[model samples]
Target: MTAPITMFGPDFPFAYDDFLSHRAGLGAVPAAAHGTEIAIIGAGIAGIVAGHELMKLGLKPVLFESDRIGGRLRSEPFKDGAGAYAELGAMRFPPSSRALFHYFDKVGIETIGFPNPLAPDTPSTVIELGGVKHYARTKDDLPKRFAEVERAWAEALEEGAHYGELTAAIRARDVATIKRLWHHLVESLDEESFSGFIANSKAFRELGFRAREMFGQVGFGTGGWDTDFPNSILEILRVVATGADDEHRLVVGGVEQLPRRLWALVPEVMAHWPSGTSLASLHNHVPKPGVAKIAPGTTKKFAITDRYGTTTEYDAVIVTCQVWLLSARIDCSESLFHHDLWMAMERTHYMQSSKTFVMVDRPFWRDVDPATGEHALSMTLSDRLTRGTYLLDNGEDKPGVICLSYTWSDDALKWLALPLDDRVRLMLHSLRQIYPTLDIAQHIIGAPITVSWESDPNFMGAFKANLPGHYRYQRRLFSHFVQDDLPEPHRGIFLAGDDISWTAGWAEGAVTTALNAVAGIIRHLGGTAHPENPDPIDRWSDLAPVRLVE
Candidate 1:
């Protein structure tokens, strides 16, 4: 694993004393002395990669971020004596994440496959209906309740089977397959509910029994397609199920180690802006009403506000903030920003999820002779009793160091809204459900519940995903930076984010979009760009043969 790069060592960017001294005098920086090639907002993976690529081309790119350098990939010190960090958000990575893996390899960040000891010995997925636990040992073992899943899967394949032979299934005339795929997508993608889709399916009578339970398992939350803009659930499932491997991987040390390495690769030409500073607004030079000034030169300005409310500006700005945050600052009337983009962005739904990290003074689960060594880090589907827990091996030599994360959906919003005491009681209750053998109340060191989706202002949700009709608008919203559409002098402000790329809502998506944005910027700068590898999995016709077992 690569060591962290310490840019500002002894002196933190803004000292508390300095903050107290100049609490109110913060203001925006005025006009630029020279023109900037590119400006990216939100220093997440996409912005970081885009800036890195542009710097390689000898263009001075400026980046802006409202929070820490690593967006969702943040790690906090565990409250227990584990002597390791706990991940607040994203946790797993697949082997097919070539771009992500390549970046890690280039930067010398090592990774190990996500371990599942229960696998082969026991099924990984468990369905908790009421108080009873039904272990899904295999596809065939899915409770009689989920019988409709087979039918839904079959119907989806049948609809698109004809497009398998076509050169471009996307262009095939079979709208039925496309529509079936759209219906199976999560609510965030389409207005129709899973129940509605199952109802409309050929075997509704047979599958309707498990409707509510199945919906909970497969349903997309606020971040899914049902919210602001809906996405095709079928397409997302196809991409996730087909293109990727089943194994999960962990970054050596922590996930933050990955971004820290990427930051080191950035060239000297690209300016490194401090965290918490974001673009407030843009200033343009307009000469006349219908006809604007033709210096052919444009000055990209920003109004960056820091954590302490201190605001500053840069000549050129590279915005890496969330779309919702950026929408507030941009002047849509200039035609430089698309109205459709703004609308879609405004309507985007963020998931209300929470992570409660409990540091135990002792390894309670180990009392039951729990799986030891690298066989830790157990991943389990959530249940009403246990909620859900991802056990992490803090990489400690001692056996007692363990971090338990409770990832809950609607309960999070409710828990966060409740008073402190009520929240604590609820959490303890949830924890007890999982470790019935251990005394959770006595061994607890600290329990910090991070409600990311509800608290973070910049990003309303965790990441972007497609809904039913979202694909129709995705190409337009994601591909907003076509050469002809952008403002003067800067034709390469290609849209790049987890939402913009084909792989939406993952580290891979961020990397893919960054590569695409870099390609666009390189082309505009009269430089060559590298081509991406073709997707290995075929979307339309690669379904596994269905069989009937009696």
Candidate 2:
């Protein structure tokens, strides 16, 4: 059984154990609903998990992927193919993400603590501020100024956001306390930006904007909170208060395997469908064409036209693609969903991101500097062009990988037009300025690969970060997964992905939302959640996610 999660705001905070412990087959497919076919858009983690679980419940799910499987959970192999690869997206997993771990454990994925710059698993960290450099192997070694900034953030959360009370209420599953505490917060903080919260808070007010500047340059968890400073304060509180930023681990081989393994799994038995049916068998071991358009069909079903113009009919469709695709890429009908839902999807703010990586001969940064007696290079962070650098050591005699640079938002936008070689050169140039004596280029043994998510049509941008005053928009999107929230016309289609979830940018949100949609889909098809286990919304409706409209 999975652990129970405590959360704030509209992020569905439900017990994963309840989902597994239900007596009825998860979603409890009805005799009439047996062999119900579901059309799942996108082959990302969200789509794959939803499709996989639906299959287990005796439903047939056909997945369509415009690109390759795994979507954003992709791992790119280095050019020379020396078994070295770079995690182009989603490189770490937090222990608090029980829903994600459930899948990871089932797939037998091996994980170790990711070297998160100044994190414990990392041997050292080099932080650059202004023009000065400070090298430290632990948090204690950080300059006093950095310590002050960290404390201010902690204190700001406690006073300005009521972080402790909210988390404690959630941990205890005290619904009454949670609703009272969180509803007040949503009203007060919904229109507030992260920077605004930090500015007016007692600790931050005393420390001033300088502290805010440092936090933005090298954020504690995801790095460079500045890009997100304009985002809702509630979003940041949900991440830190829930312990989602602590105790992170990286999948050993690659995180993408979690989804890939699931695709290969063939259930022992299924309804109507033959035993040992897999996604490959269902699609004839071929790539299902991309969906070009979606509209309501003549009957109470959905009509999805593929890239090749072949239309398919299904009782329901779960769109796992990012919201922007509905407007920017696909030819979706306006009448298919509520006008408010269209606004939310169109207004979603996807943060820009870029990552440049290279394969190296070995972990040269592990070597001690002869003059300073400190390691040659630690996982580094700076306000320079190369905002942050990460190292991946693959043991002796194996090629090592270095994320030469990882940046976000405006910083990321700077390199959106640069070619891979230009990006690598500029990043190395910035690194040389920090480490004057080290000739880092000599260690390179393979071709470099880079990603500018905003430039890629498949992925308009990295992930979502809700902007100030966007609660109503998010509420519309998040609740869309629940069939009851929609009007008669929109009842047959559902939305599930990180963007629709409260905790965007995390895989946990993607998986959790997908599960929620699965239950909703079952309900829409006249099925039911197990009698032993009430629906998540039904069980916690009193403590339901904060309502922006009501």
| Top of the candidates by TM-score | 2
Candidate 2 lDDT over 283-385, as tens digits, reads: 7765478999998887548888999999988898899999899998889889888888899998999999899998889888889977788888778899999
Q: Can you give the TM-score per candidate against the true fold?
A: 0.67, 0.96
Over 4 Å off, model 1: 1-37, 79-82, 115-127, 134-195, 203-205, 218-231, 241-245, 266-318, 329-335, 362-382, 399-411, 419-424, 431-437, 447-449, 485-492, 528-550
lDDT tens per residue, model 1, 97-149: 65676677766877765433233322233444455654443546556545555
Model 1 gets an lDDT of 0.46
- 16 Cα displacement, candidate 1 (Å): 44
Name the lDDT of candidate 2. 0.83
Compared with the true structure, all predictions reach lDDT values of 0.46, 0.83
Clashing pairs in 2: 219-224
